[model samples]
Target: MTAAERIARDFTLLLPPGWARIPLDGRVPLRVKNLVTERVADVPVEQRETLRAALTRELTAVLESAARQGGLDVLLSVAPVAGQPVPASGLVTHLAGQGNGDALDSLVGTLAAGSGTSSVREIGVVEVAAGPAVRRLTTRRERVDGQGDLPGGVLTVTQVDYFVPLPGTRDLLVLTFTTPIEQLAPPLVQLFDVMGGSLRWVTR
Candidate 1:
């Protein structure tokens, strides 16, 4: 390829997964698709390469920065009861004697007679304490498939899982890193150990 060809081709080289070439509204307008879940967002022509490059550089820098300040992201999802905690069924019952009593009373009486009234009124109320707080780790290595932190030829991500405190709370944390599978060695272990040591009373 000649110089001009090389320059033109460089327009789309080394883009991360999930990013596709897109037409833009301005001069030299092109964008990469976000490779993981969503397609790479539209770039403002001037920022595509900058954003991608920054994603590469900033991911490592951010992780290192976070390590210095302490804490990484943890995702802990909890599925609560499917319905609303407070049902409005009894609200109508309690206010049955109020202004619009006749219709509400009639509806309640009919429903009660049917023996299929909202049992939600009787379900035990258990207010779960505020759970953990996990933040999204802004990763510089934006592409899922490319760029890893592997060093010394030993991959051990599956062999590891970790939890951290939510900054200033006792609530536990869970999160995943954008770092490469092979790269989670000392720092990963260290973070896990530190959190584990601090929470030995709560966690076994």
Candidate 2:
């Protein structure tokens, strides 16, 4: 399999019960479980889709904390905006900046520091748009780290990944952020059991 596909497989293991991945055009489906009802639901997109969740605010703060301690890649969930039919533009700044790895790194840092590392798996059914869709984000923070080969423009970077059931319903939202972020899938699988058997999202 291609590296990206492998990454996708690795990441899918992170989902919790009731959660699932629904394949929509231009979307990488990611499914999650319902917290209370034990119902399963499908998240429309993957990649930065978790950012599309409702917990963006809370997650930003949590990841911010975790990054301070070590590297982080979070898998969290948030409720979706019902009937809202996710706007072509996400509520959160999905495409906030478009530049080099430093710029991306900075954005990640800021998100991590502000939100702190979060383990909130409450949200579900979020719409996400990565690469160029987020046109109106203001750089909350910026730090140039010229240490690595690709010195990142660190922003206390933190990624808030959230999942929510469809129709603004309350369900299990899973959030986990730490480095080796590539390991997001397995944790998510565990998350499924934690919440209860839910949806098994379809993979591409």
Candidate 3:
């Protein structure tokens, strides 16, 4: 049997409580509305509708942006991780190739050398439940001026990307974790590390 035939085409991830997978379908608006409603359920009834409307609009925009960036699924977290309340999010994407670890390493090297506002904080191979994977941490300073409802300022976003190579294939499944909460980066990164370690390949 060929390598592709011997390997699984699917994988699974374990997300903690309060982390939700946003569907990238035509019904995204509806899903956002439902999520907004649930999130504002504790607000005063008199101001619930207004708050819901505002949150729905904002969240819809975020999800739409994720889709435009080739994200398969956008995961949003609003609860505590590692015993601290830290709001963060993630995106899953795939890259198809025809090489092996050497190819992945070359790709990583290219990424590390790319010029941008973002800087690579760390890059190395880490063993997870699925096997060896390349982990890269980066931070970018984004200007929030004229960017939707965000206030005018430089927003520092911390991101961690895991490039997991499929067994017997050059293709990779990438998990990207990001957060604008720079003050809580250490714990948030730890949470991302745990999440990445939980990834498991599913067999046919």
Candidate 4:
């Protein structure tokens, strides 16, 4: 059997309460509508619709952007996790093996070195529930165009990435947690670390 076939065809991870898993599919709009409805339910009846529509549009845009970036799934937290208000998000993407058998460390090193203007905060092998994986943290400034009353400027985005290699293959499942809320980065990253520790491989 091929290495990929011998291992699991997919994997799973644990997300804290209030986290929503959004798959890239035809039902994205429907799913976003549901999420917006639930989140804006507490708003005044007259304002709820307006709020819902705005949120739905913004979220749909984010999900579509992630899909175009090769993300397999997007995990978004609209509520607080563990009593702290964290609106962080995550993206799951896959990196297929080159078949030339490059080592995981070498692959990670190459990725870290290609971060362009982003600063690599940390990179090392870390032990988690799944096994040893490469953990990389980075921060970069991203420009945001002004919209409505919001002024356009650059925002610092912090990201924590876990590169878990599938057993018997050089393929990697990448879990990337990101947040633009720089003030709350510490707690957000701590939550992300716990979530990363909960990753598991599912055998076919």
> For this target, which candidate reaches the highest lDDT against the unseen true structure?
4
For all predicted structures, in order, the TM-scores are 0.20, 0.20, 0.81, 0.84
Query: Which regions of candidate 4 are displaced past 4 Å?
Result: 1-9, 80-85, 98-102
lDDT score at residue 150, model 4, on the 0-100 scale: 92
> Model 4 misses residue 4 by how many Å?
6.0
Please give, for residues 49-158, the per-residue lDDT of candidate 2 as tens digits.
45345434444454444335332233334334443321111111111122233243443444445443443333222232211100111112346668658765644322
Per-residue CA lDDT of model 1 for 1-204, tens digit only, reads 233222221211121222122222132112112321121245566766776676545333433443343332211111112431111000000011111212333433443344332121211111112222122212122223334664344322221222223222323333232234435434643443333233212211
* Model 4: per-residue Cα lDDT over 103-197, one tens digit each: 65676778788878889999877887888888899999999999999999989999999888877676777889999978889998999999987
- What lDDT tens digits, residue by residue, belong to model 3 across residues 1-204? 235423422677788788887757678888887888788888899999897888888788889899898666788875445666456888887666733665657766766887266889998778889887888999999877665775587778999988888876787778899888788899889999999888889976
TM-score of 1: 0.20
Q: What is the lDDT of residue 91 in candidate 1?
A: 4
Q: Best TM-score goes to which candidate?
A: 4
Q: Which ranking of candidates, highest lDDT first?
A: 4, 3, 2, 1
For each candidate, the alpha-carbon lDDT, in order, equals 0.27, 0.30, 0.78, 0.81
